[model samples]
Target: MWGGDRLDNYVEQLRKERGLNQEEFAKAIRVSRQTVSAIENGKYNPSLDLAFIISDFFGKTIEEIFIYKGGADK
Candidate 1:
């Protein structure tokens, strides 16, 4: 059951843990709040550059934020 949580759920968890509202997090990541909402709702997969920016902002690796459900080998 690894990497099973929905993207929205994971983002919500991270937002709460980091004490960031959508507007604040979006500002930090230089995206619109609606964009953050879309990402949190699993409606979008950010570009690699944006992904890296987000991971760096949170001090986490991309793998930590975006899970690969089928395992590393896919």
Candidate 2:
């Protein structure tokens, strides 16, 4: 669990920046569109494996995409 850490991600932004819709981005990461929607809406925190996949697809680190706030940031 992330404890008090809030899951903040820039997936939607990055996806649009790459000209990908949710379905396209989801396909790129091999997940369902619902999963991408959930992550973008902050309703789900991706597992480490999915996180790495997303990060790699965007050529970014997990910290760059999903920002874990409220722990050391506080």
Candidate 3:
């Protein structure tokens, strides 16, 4: 297992910037609100496929949306 959360994302910020709440953003990305919440709270590390989906939804690159700190950034 991993030591801690090493992945973080700006999903909440980006969603808010677009004026979309969790539910709306989840709909846009074809995810559940719980999934969006989990990602925003740093409790989940999405698979590569989901990462790409998020990047595509935001018109951003995977690296732009997901930050890999090498270790727990919490």
Candidate 4:
């Protein structure tokens, strides 16, 4: 699971389920493929606008996409 509950794997899964490659999905969401790749690799934290775009693209809420693991849980 990429990034665990941080949403990277969720995005990857969603992208695959939609039969979208990184380039295609990135174009659909108006972001560079590198940005999408970075997000999936957990090398980037998406801006609020980008996050919303991703959520909307996947038909999921922000919380459903990005889950924050609190220190207490660790």
Candidate-wise lDDT, in order: 0.75, 0.87, 0.84, 0.80
Looking at candidate 4, what is the lDDT of residue 23? 99
Clashing residue pair totals per candidate (backbone < 3 A):
0, 0, 0, 0
lDDT of 4 by residue, 1-74 (tens): 22334434368878999999999999999999998998887777788898899999999998888766645345
Show where candidate 1 strays beyond 4 Å: 1-9, 71-74
Candidate 3: residue 6 lDDT (0-100): 73
Query: Model 1: number of clashes?
Result: 0
Q: Tens-digit lDDT track for model 3 on 6-54? A: 7778988998999999999898889889988888888787778988999
Q: Write the per-residue lDDT of candidate 1 for residues 32-55, one digit (tens) a residue.
A: 999888777777767779879888
Looking at candidate 4, the ten consecutive residues that score lowest on lDDT are 1-10
Give the TM-score of each candidate. Answer: 0.77, 0.87, 0.87, 0.81
Give the Å error, residue 3, model 4: 10
Worst 10 residues of 2 by lDDT: 1-10
Clashes of 3: 0
